[model samples]
Target: SEMMIMANWLMARFLSERNLPAIFRSQPDPKERLYNEDQGTLFQNWMQRRLLSRFVLSSRSERHSGLGLNAYLTATSPIRKYFDLVTQRQIRSAFDLDTPYTDREIERSLHSLEQPMFSVSRLQYQRKRYWLLKYLEERIGKKEEALVLNRRRNGYQVLLTEYLTECMLPVSSGVSMRSEDMIQVTIQHVNARKDTLSVYMA
Candidate 1:
């Protein structure tokens, strides 16, 4: 949690310093989501839209994770992320290490890397969602307690308080809910192929 608090502050500082429209890639709280990690995939869809600068964030309690740090670069996931690969090349260049890819060469690759990286990320997301859906299918009819994270147009989105899961529940036309409200929800439906989960208020 302390790491996340520090990371979040660093992210805030970086954004404030540059005034850039930014992308924050955050995962679930390490205290919890570190186990299942789907919370990390919470905003897979939003991160891909046409955006300004890209940066990483981690460890937020809500769906969006934020671990604030002044600067972060990926040096892992060579197959799934080009930026990490580029970072690796940059590190090599810093050590006066000879390689086919130079700092300048990697610098020139960023423009082309964005779209492809996004595609790779989306594919991996779909794969994970598939497995999660399958897991949900097995647990159908079970009731779980969740925290109200946000109230949306149709209803509310809740994060499972005990399990590493989340889902949306539609409100009766005039009903309302507030953030942080504790609610009970039943795992009602799951479609693995479509990556859809249906939950009903209990």
Candidate 2:
């Protein structure tokens, strides 16, 4: 936890120092508050929009409602994120008094990047879930607990604390499960190849 906090603090400092337009990761819950009015009017509201987006790259604006920044872009890592590489090239060329790409080229890239990123995100999630399901498959019958994230009509969607994965719990105990409820549960069955899990409330 200390490492994470320090890493974020360092990144924020680095971005502020460069005065570069970079990507800012926002808070997950758009309605969640993180600050008091004493901090700033916008900061508190911005805290709520986290997890609502992936990487937001805008060469155009640095203002992230959540980051409370005047300008931002995503040029932090060239290899990890293609968007960062593109932004870095643009910044470097501008410093050398030149343009890196034509206006049409930039527009074309903007059009193509969305789908590729979305596909990659979906694949990454599926892959992780596949491995977790495999782990659960080996441990079936072990009693576990889950955090309620969403309540469905027939069941409830729960987040498994151990695996850090969410799956449906087949029983709801005849009540509307509230969010963040720590409900006792057990792993009934799991199929890794099929990427499926069957869970029940304890």
Candidate 3:
């Protein structure tokens, strides 16, 4: 199923490219900046990050206010993931007994499901983070262009050019910077044991 979804997305991209108008494909007689200072106001609503919540349901009725029951009822997962087996068992038990799990019971089950998954995710992040710090440590004292992504009272976050990896820039480095600024920076510190990389404006 995942392969099929990926194949379909690839096909869509190919088709979109093939169907693009010739004018869009050809070089402009005189290229112009795609966006200008005057248009900055048009993108004011763009946020760096935002969280979203959604509820899914299967059926709707007057009493339900048309919100409907969960449509994910028929969802299935392969045996590889433990949660799928647990879900299959719970669903079978519910149907066989003619009584679905209570809302609180379902909520508790879902909440508990996150623990192992989060552990796995954290482990993978730590592994990658270890390699990133090691790579940066070898390049200490080297300079590179970076974009500031965040600012705090003590330090800021900068994304390096080559790896696009983020590292901290301490205020004590005496290099003043603001978020979203592009500037040349040098690695000032790297603690591979702690998976930390620190930099200063070059």
Cα lDDT computed for each candidate against the true fold: 0.57, 0.62, 0.51
Candidate 2 or 1, higher lDDT: 2
Candidate with the greatest lDDT versus the true structure? 2
Tens digits of lDDT, candidate 3, 75-172: 24436755444444544454464344444655565566557767997899888888888887888999988877778777886677577577777767
True-structure lDDT of candidate 2: 0.62
Backbone clash count, each prediction separately? 9, 15, 7
Rank candidates, TM-score, best first.
2, 1, 3
**Candidate 2 vs 3: which has more TM-score:** 2
Model 3's lDDT to the true fold? 0.51
RMSD, model 1, all Cα superposed? Answer: 10.2
110-182 in candidate 2: lDDT tens per residue? Answer: 6778789789999998888888787788888888877787668778777777776768877746566676678
Model 3: CA > 4 A from native: 1-47, 50-80, 84-109, 171-176
Provide the lDDT at 102 for model 3: 49
* Superposition TM-score, candidate 1 onto the true structure: 0.57
> Against the true structure, whose TM-score is highest?
2
